[model samples]
Target chain A: MPEMYFSDAIRAALDEALTRDASVVLMGEDIGPYGGAFGITRGLHEKYGPERIIETPISENGFVGVAVGAAMTGLRPVVEIMFMDFILLAADQIINHAAKLHYIYDGQVKVPLVIRAPAGAGRGYGASHSQNLENVFLSVAGLKIVCPATPADAKGLLAAAIRDPNPVLFIEPKALYGARGEVPEGDYTVPLGVARLAREGKDLSIITYGACVPLALAAAGELSEGGLEADVLDLRTLKPMDLTALEATVAKTGRCIVLEEGPLTGGIGAEVSARIGERCFRALKAGVQRVAAQDTPIPSATPLEHAVLPSVAALLAAADRLFE
Target chain B: MPEERLLSAYRKMLLIRLMEERIGALFTEGAIAGTCHLCIGQEAVAVGVAEALELGDEVVSCHRGHGHLLAMGGEPARLLGELMGRQIGYCRGRGGSQHLSAPGIGLLGTNGITGGGIPIATGAALSAHLLRTGAAIVCFFGDGATNQGVFHESLNMAALWSLPVLYVCENNRYAMSEPVCRTVAGGDILARPRAYGISAECVDGMDVEAVEAAARRALAPLRAGKGPAFIEAATYRFCGHSKSDKLLYRTREEEAKWRERDPLTLTRLKLEKAGWKETLPWIEEEVRRQIAEAEEACRRSPLTPPETALQGVYADA
Candidate 1:
């Protein structure tokens, strides 16, 4: 294993898929020559050529729907939306067509398309560009949502997403793209609906995913200093969620705090916590708590954005409050 | 041979008209659950374009898509079963009239949203190009869909990438109750595609032969992978937009004027003048028999069990 940026890990997974399958294609705005808005797909166009690495116009609705159609026929298309907020433009294609095509057609068609969108609010991109829309897609039944916290999981999860015979929404935390971690070299796939233990503990469980994983782990380390050990769980796949792992973790610790980057109301945290209450209520030492962003648009100013989003300090405080 | 081709197109169109009428009758009888958008008068566009398609060619149809599905060799019993919400339906009763798909016959699906299928059809063309399948894609949309942003975006992308897609806009002079003239800018719908640099043709959709000829010419360049093409079929929907529509938007005189140039009547007269008078009766008898069988099949197909409702939401999840 070698330490690599999360962005590089994604690129490596895409490169492996492209090499393995001739039908695998990359389509997105500025994903070819410009490499991508975040520079993740850099040099792929040169290596894979124009046919495989398609540079699309600023048409999210057009290109996303095209990916769905391409997937329906024979090709395995991985469409990249510049930002998670931009997925709103392509919602009909993703939610209505891509998600329902296989089921509505009674399993006649397979929409093997991966929609990669960079989400989360941290870099002061304003309300429009920096909102986490994963919760918006959680209600959509057929589509799978994967948000990787570690570089290794990012590579493995993305590889699996490309190979899966269904539509997958790969949400990359924009804040974590440059974060470095050890990723395996060769073919590896992190199965969807599986959770990874970021840190082992017995006091309580810090249930989280995506960019919040590191923050939860950091908060767990701080809590350990105060003689309280917490289990930090990284839920790689959000949809078809790893409730088995959740049960195990909750049964072990008997207390939990679900963390997310999106707004508090009707967010992923609410769903996870509700499930925890329903399934693991007998084991719970305390009610399931949710530490998430305030119900307000992510702002352009750094101070205001920090106030709106959940911070590592906030998680540490929440953990301390849980013990109290 | 020419007469046979014309007759085949005519038969498909007649099947659509009859099937839509039957579905409407079923809805009135409260046998059909969901509402339907009928393609009664605008049959020529679907029949003509479907006539031009080669085997394995795909189509993405819009909300008013019964005609397109029927023209693409869709099974009457399965389609009727779908509207009746039975297990034997094309979508197994999950998707009703607004969302019908028969991939076996190369129809992707009838989309529920306006202009939603345009990009999906473009993607199918992209797939054909990438897979070297040599199959073309025909996207059927309505006049209302032209206002959607994806319509313009899909056409621009298809043209720019040389995708093998023929965008067929059934400009039936109305978008639901709203007239197209008032909704669309400049009121010249054909100019939309021409602005995208894609070759566009305005065809008389009441004349199946004219539409078929226009489709053949438009599809030639598309099948050859030269580029995308657009055909604005000037047609009219004889019925109200949907089962809920009260027909309050337009005048009876306006409707009467369009009815005089009805596609079925136009095709019947053309066939009669071409000495194919006997063909109409024979075709009508065959269609009537098929419709009867389809109705029986619909009655026989069972409803899906409540326990299995959650199945097929995700495969191998």
Candidate 2:
């Protein structure tokens, strides 16, 4: 294992899939010579040539649908939406076609497609560009949502998503793209619908995924110093959620906090907490809490954005109250 | 040989007409759980395109898709059963009229969403183009669907990438109740595909042979990997848009005029001109027998179990 940036880990997965399978292709705007908006696919165009790494003209709806079609016809296409904000344009294809085609046709087609897009707020990208839309797809039955926390899981989860039989939405936390962590060499996969414990503790459970995973770890570190240990659970795949691991952590700690970067109402936190309240009610010593963004749109100003998104300080404060 | 060709085309168009009329009856009887859009006057377009396609070549259809499915070799009994929400249906009773699909027989899918199947068809062409599979795709959409953004996007990408897809727009004069003239910008769906640089043509959708010939010509360029082609079939739907449509949008005179140019009638005339007039009675008998058998099959099929509804949400699950 060697330390690598989270962005590079994703690139590595794409590179490996393209090399290993002829059906694998990269499609997006400026992914070729431009190497993608954030330069994640920078050198891939030069390596794989223009045909395999396709460049389109800002038509997310068209290309994502093309990926769905290709998936049905034996081509494993990995489509990149430059920013998660633009994913709304392609939502029709994803939800109506890609997600339902398999079931709609009574298992006649398998849409082995992956749509990778960078999401979340850290930079001042304003309302549309900085929002996390995982909640939009959380309830879509055929769609699988995977958010990687570490460099290792970034490569592993993406590899698994690419090889998956169903449609997968690979949401990248843009804030953590440059974060450095260890990833294995060559190919590997972190199975979907499995949770990983970022840190081991007993007093309380800190449940989170994607960008919030790192923040939960930081909060747990502060809690640990104050003689309050917490279990930080990283949910790698959110759709076919790993309830087994989630309940285990909550039942072990008997207290939990659900954290997400999306808006609070009908968000990931709300869904997870409702299930936790039902199944893990007897295991709880304290009421289940949620730390998420406000129901307002993400702002452009740094301070305002900070107030909107979940923070490590907020996680700690929530943990302190769980003890009281 | 030409007489048999005319006869075969006549049979498919007649089958769609009769089958859809049966589906309408089923809808009225409460046997059909969901709404179904009939392609009564537009059979030539679907039957013709499917006739021109190779065995492995696929056809993707829009909401008015039962014709496309049947023309592409979908079993009538199974399609009827599926529409009736029976366990022994094409989608195992989950998908109904709008979602009819038989992938193994090259009927890719029928989308409920307008303009949704355009990209899927374009992508199938892309897969064929990339893999050199030589399987061209035929996407059947309505005049209304041409206004959808994906229609423009799919046509552009298909032309840009040299994908082998034949985009057939069944301009049935109206989208539910709104006429295409009012809904489409510039009132020309044909102009849209041409602007995207695709090889385009318009044919009288009432004449099965004319549509079949146009589709055959389109497929030659597509199969050669030249690029995508567009065929605007000037057809009309004889029935109302759905089970609930009251037919208030058009005058009865207009509907009667289009009915005179009905695909089945036109194809029957073609058969008569080919000196197959004596065989018409026997052909009619064969069609009636098949439709009756299909109706019986679906009626006999048991209701789909409730638990099975939860089964297909995920392929792996």
Quick one: best lDDT, which candidate? Answer: 1
- Residue A295, model 1: Cα distance from true site in angstroms: 1.9
Clashing pairs in 1: none
RMSD of 2: 1.1
- In DockQ, how does model 2 score against the reference complex? 0.78
Candidate 1 lDDT score at position A45 = 97
Across residues B139-244, which tens digit of lDDT does each residue of candidate 2 receive? 9999999888888899889989989999999999999999987999898777898998998999999988899899999999788878999999998988999988
- Give the runs in model 1 whose Cα sits over 4 Å from its true position: none
Clash number by candidate, in order: 0, 0
List model 1 lDDT by residue over A111-208, tens digit each.
Answer: 99999999988998999999999999999989999999989999999999999999999999999999999999999998988999989999999999
